[model samples]
Target: MASMKFACIVIMCFAVVGAPIAQAISCGQVGNNLKPCLRYIMSFWGSVPGLCCDGVKTVMAHVQNTADKRATCNCLKSMVAKIGFVPWRAKSIPRECGVVLPYEISTSINCDKLEL
Candidate 1:
């Protein structure tokens, strides 16, 4: 009985600790995180903003799984299509911000096919 109780407590601890890690990544969250990069994306040539790099790093840190990655990719692709950012500028964002993305940022990227 004592062992069973200990196991249950352990399971509960894991559930509580892992709750935030399992939280879903939504498009709204992605958009809000990346919003600071809009000025850099729209510019023809300029230094990447501190806030934009911070946002990029934040987004990258939050993306902890394949699902989160795919969702982020899809959200970015849709944003790029709608906002009409310069292709090269958009592609340079991760490197400029010192964040190494798993895949290239582009409208043509196959988000559904991304792997962890």
Candidate 2:
């Protein structure tokens, strides 16, 4: 009986804690998708790489709706925040890659501000 009760408690704890993880966009995923573009995004004097454009398209393709777009923007903002990237450089990533996104990838973007 005690073991069963413990199992139930553990399940409840996991359910509560894991819910957000399931819904939230992860930084690691974003990083992986854009990893190939890192050099171009960081550098001021280089052409956008072909792989970088592919990565941008793949990442943008996943953003199918307003919520996904917001989450992706937030995830990207977090990534740029950690790396101390130029906001304009980040904003120009999609454009430079010839990919259009619903929201601009600027530092000032408010994830929840606009709806698709």
Candidate 3:
């Protein structure tokens, strides 16, 4: 009975501890991380800010799976559409920041089809 109780406690601990890891990346997180890059993304010609690169790297680091990538992509697309940024400037952000993204950053990108 003691062993069974311990096992139950272990299981409950895993359920509680692992829940956040299994949860999908939220748009709020995506927005917060990418917010610093807006100025660079909007400008026609200028150096990418260090803060912007840091933000990009931070967001990319959080993408643990395809679902997270898709969620981030969708969030980015929605943000771009609403804010109206230069497409090429936005697409170049990852490269300028020394981060290689699997998908291009564009509003037309189909987030549902994103893969790891």
Alpha-carbon lDDT, every model: 0.85, 0.76, 0.86
Q: Considering lDDT, which of the candidate structures 1 and 3 is the better prediction for this target?
A: 3
Candidate 2, 19: how far from true, in Å? 23
lDDT of 3 at 70: 90
lDDT of 2 at 21: 35
**What would the per-residue lDDT of candidate 2 be over residues 1-116, giving only the tens digit for each residue?**
99999999999999888865334445577778789877776777677778878878877777767887788888877777667565667778778878887777766778887576
Q: Please give the range of 10 consecutive residues that has the lowest summed lDDT in model 2.
A: 19-28
Residue-level lDDT for 88 in candidate 1: 83
lDDT by residue (tens digit), candidate 1, 1-116: 99999999999998888755457668898888889889888879787888888888888887888888998899888988898687788789889888899988788999999988
Off by over 4 Å in 2: 1-26
Candidate achieving the largest lDDT = 3
Sorted by lDDT (best first), the order is 3, 1, 2
* Alpha-carbon lDDT of model 1: 0.85
RMSD of 1: 4.2
| Candidate order by decreasing TM-score | 1, 3, 2
lDDT by residue (1-116, candidate 3, tens digit) is: 99999999999999888865446668898888888888878878787888888988988888889888999899998999998698989988888889988899887899999889
